[model samples]
Each structure stands twice: as structure tokens, then as C-alpha cells.
Target: MKQLQKLKILDLQDNRIQGLIPNDLCHLQNLGSLALSENELFGQILTCLRNFTFLREIFLDSNKLTSIIPTNLFNLEDILYLNLSSNYLSDYLPPHIGRLKAVIQIDLSVNNFSSNIPSEVGGLQTLADLSLAHNRLQGPVPESFGNLISLQSLDLSYNNLSGVIPKCQKRERTPPQTELLPTLAHGRIAYQELLRATDGFSDSNLLGTRSFGSVYRGTFTDGTILAIKRLDIMTDLACALDYLHHGYSTPLVHCDLKPSNVLLDEDMVAHLCDFGIAKFLGEGESIAHPNTLATLGYIAPESPQERINMREALAALKKIRHQFTQAVKGEKHEDCIALRGESVGSSSEP
Candidate 1:
């Protein structure tokens, strides 16, 4: 492969190619495009890829690649499109990412990357699309992001990010005007009007029912369609737990958290019920041993021996939710489900 020095393009995407990306390919210094996405390739990205100075596009998404993205990879100052999404990449997204001044689209979603997003990323003036969703990133969205004048799409969802979004100023170049949806003055719709739009919440309009509440597809007389969730039960539950765990000086743990213990109001708001086994952690204490036990399946694994705190329980619930989502999406998650079942079965054995 090193003999292919003059190769300008190398596209072997969507194949069953397995194993590490060969280093010899880096010898093609003049390569303008490289596409190796949707394969079974595993291992870290080639560090030598930085030597491909003429490379314009690199597609290495939907693979089993792992480890931190090489800082040198961002040295491709002339590269246009970069897709490294759906990998197992981890570690802080290097601050050097700002060096890709000419890149237009960048997708690094569905990875294990952690730490704060570098504010330097907003320096990519030519960036049009950016996605860093479904990662373990924490901290507020960078205020510098408001400077992305060419950004048409941005996604940072499913992260531990907090704080207010920076208001992006009007772009220098205005896009064509198009009416995508009906404009509302105050973004408020009357309850009676909503009822009428949803046909009094009829079964035919029902979209889906989650553990918290039901969603409906509502169509107005003006041919406007909207997906409306009747209740924010999960959000309410999370808020209640947050209050119990952090709002008060002494953190309180809801020892028994199960479907039956959650009560819903007429307005479809969820309330935590049955705090009979709730325990308050002492100063500097994290876990507590209670005389009463929570429902078997609802209890965390450490509940039997070393009891878990509210935060630990919440983390376990989040894991379960992620697994459930994978199952619903029909991904290859049977092994995870089977392992969970085995663990539950073992826990039940006296």
C-alpha cells in the first residue's frame, strides 16, 4: 500500500473490512479523500494521518475504533469534512480541533468522550454542521459557539452540559426566507384549543406511551401538526429526586423507587410516593443501611450488602434507561439484556 504514493483518493467504505487501519496508507501523502466508514475496523485512529496534508475528507464513522482522537489529526488545516461518529473514542476533545479552519461538517457523536468541550472549537469559522451528542461531556456550552457564523446545525444533546445557551447573532449572509411552521406571538396555545387539536386526546391521535406519560400527534384546523406530550412525568420525577438529594442540607434518599410508588395527578404530573423507607444521610455520609428493603428488581445490586445512595440508584436507573433505549431501537443489545437477567437471577438466590 505504501507503493501507492500517488493515490489521490481511497474509498473502501461500507465493507466488512476488519482489523487496524494500516499505517502504510499514510504514505499516500497526496490523498485528497479517505472513506472507510461502516466497517468492523477496530483500534485507534492512525496518528500518521496528520501527514496527509492534502486530505480534504475523512469518513471513519460506524466502526469499533477506540481511544482518544490524535491531536495531530486536527493538523489537517485544509481538510473539509470529518466524520468520526459512532466510535468508542474517549478523552478530552483536544483544543487543537480549532486548527481545522477550513472544515465544513464535523460529527463526533455517540462516543465515550468526556470533559469540557474546548471553547476553541468556535474558532472554526467555516464550520456548518457539528454534532457531539451522546457523550459523557460536562460543563456549559461554550459561549464562543455563538461566533460560528456559518453554523447551520448544531447538536450537543444527551450530555451533562448545563447553563444558558449563548445567543447567536444574525448571520452576515441571510438565507432564503421560508415559512416552515405557523408563528405564535408568545408561543402559548390555549388548553381548550389544544384539546380540540388533539380531538379530546382520542386513541387515534395517541403516538406512544412511555413510563411517565403518553404522547399524541395533534393536527390543527390550519393543517399544522404537532407532537405534544400530555405530561412531563419523568421530568417531574427527576426534579423531585433532585430536590430530595440536593435541595435540602441533609440529602434524602428514596429507598423504594418503583412504578407503583409513583403517583400521577389530574394534570399528569408525577409525584414520588411511599417514602416510608426513605433515609436521610448524615453529614459526610453517602450510603445508609435500612431495615426495610425496596422492591427486588427496583433495588440496586449493592442494596443487599452495601446499600447504595440516591445518586448511585439514579445512575443505575439511567443505565437501565440506556439499555431500554438500545433494545427499543433493535440494536444488538440482547447480550446486555441477558447479562442483566443473569445478574438479577443471581441476586434473587439466597
Candidate 2:
């Protein structure tokens, strides 16, 4: 630990590492991903770990860890994913769990954690998945949890949790707040306004037809010329999609991406639109729900009993990610494809 000053990822998971989790590891302040899951480790999750300000993930599940979860663990604002599930961890659910402002997924399931759900859990506006299943937790779920409009998958089953599910309202989708936030959410015309801009979406203004919708050219009252694709975004879409895939707490896949779902800006930057078919690829998830085989061919085709693999989906995302990286480096589009192809191909491997 003393020699590797620049070590960023310490993935010691799935090993026979035993005894106390080293409090000394916390001295490595630059540590970003600490994955010590699936080990013979025992003892409390060291409080010293809370000081690693750069730490973004903490995976210590499937261990013999005991005692209360350290209170200050939630104070680390940069943490994106946390999993302390399948341990001997006990004590009441911390009310300030919502203090993990940047957290996207929390899985403290299959433990002895008890008590009512915290109302403040809703304050985690960026949280997408919460799993407290198979625990001894009791009492009704907090109604305030309804404010978590960003939550996609929630598992309170197999616990003592009772009462009606909270009535949450849908809100604007907020991807990870990168430098590209304003590019996606800030400048937007109203739906009705789009209709008027495209002259009632008439065929005269239509630029092309897509598998799902149409694309058109439109001008606003301010004389701003914008390409009106039936999609939700432009080049910003690629950025956001890349963020959604690799930047978030968990892997996500946008199943429907094509020309119709892409918009072009005045500067010719492309953005993605409509995540009506996006899937969060968390542990033990499925793709076998109410969707057709139509949206799986832009990168890989589904032929003669050839099923599309999840790696192909990840490759598509990697393609977008590498594309943005090359563009930022001002590389030629043609040269970057080979570089991106190798990168995406390697990433698709097990």
C-alpha cells in the first residue's frame, strides 16, 4: 500500500483474503474503486474508509462483515454505487442514507438491517435502484419515497415492508451531470412548439423517414434553424448515452437507437432521443419483457437463430464513447473507427 501511491483501482474481490479489512488501505487517498466482495473477510466495514474522498464504489458483499454500517459512509458525495449486501451487518436503517447525493444504486439486501424506510431516501434524486429485500426491516415504507422519480427498479419484497407503494410522479430524466448537461436539458422547445415549427409536421418540411418516425427541418420564431428529428436529442444524446452506459452507478443499455431517434444541431452535432426502451443492466436483470426483436440490428443483426448478445449492446455504447473521445481529441473520423473498433471489440470480450 505504501509503494503504490498512484493505484486507482484495488479490485481484491473473489479471493481468499481474510481477517480484518485493512484500515491502512484507507491511507491510499487516491483509491477510486474498492472492490473487496466475495471474500472470507470479516469485521466491520472500517470507518477509516470514509476518508477516501475519491472513492466512487464500495463493493463488500458476500462476506462475514458484522456490526453497524459506518454512519459517515453516506457523507462521501462522490460515491456512485454501494453494495454491502449478504453480510452479518445489522442495526437500524440510517435516516441520512439520502445524504449520498451522487449515489445511483444501493443494495443493502439480505442482511439484518431493520426499522422503517427513511423518508429522505427520496432526496436521492439521482438514485435509480434500491434493494432492501430479504431483510428483517419492518413497518410501512415512507410516503416521501414518492419523490424519487428517478428510481427505476425497487425491491422491498421478502421483508416486513407493508403498505401501499408510494405514488411518485414522473419527472424529466436527468443523466449524470457532465459538462454536457446544458446541451441536453437547457435548450428545448415545447412539444406544441415543435409541431408549429415543422408547419404541423407536414410532409413538405420532412427531411426523411425513419423506422419509427420522421425527421424534418424547422425554424423557430427567433429564426433559429434546427433539425427537428422525431428523436429526443442530438450529439448530446451520444454524450448522455455514453454517460448512461459507463458513467453511471450501473451499466445501462439504450435498446432503440437509430437515425430517427437522433437529432442534428445547427453545428451538425448528433444527439439521441427517446429512451422508451432503455434497460438497466444490474445484477440478475432480464431482457425478456414485452419488447420486439426489431430494435437490435444497427450494430449486430439477429439472423438464423442468432441472438443478440449483451456484449454487442455494450459494444455499441463503447463505440459511442470512443467516438466522443476521438472527437474531443480532434482525430479524423475515419482513423478513429479502427481505434474504436479495437476498443469496442476488446470490451465486448469476457
lDDT, candidates in the order shown: 0.73, 0.68
Report the C-alpha displacement of residue 86, candidate 2, in angstroms. 0.6
Cα displacement (angstroms), candidate 1, residue 315, comes to 58
What is candidate 2's lDDT per residue for 214-272, written digit by digit as tens?
A: 46667676655466777423434555454444443344566766668665544344545
Error in Å for residue 304 of model 1: 84
Error of 2 at 165 (Å): 1.1
Q: Tell me the spans in candidate 2 whose CA falls farther than 4 Å from its real position.
A: 172-350
Clashes of 2: 7
TM-score of each: 0.49, 0.52
Report model 2's TM-score to 2 decimal places. 0.52
Q: Using lDDT, give the best candidate's number.
A: 1
Candidate 2 lDDT (Cα, 0 to 1): 0.68
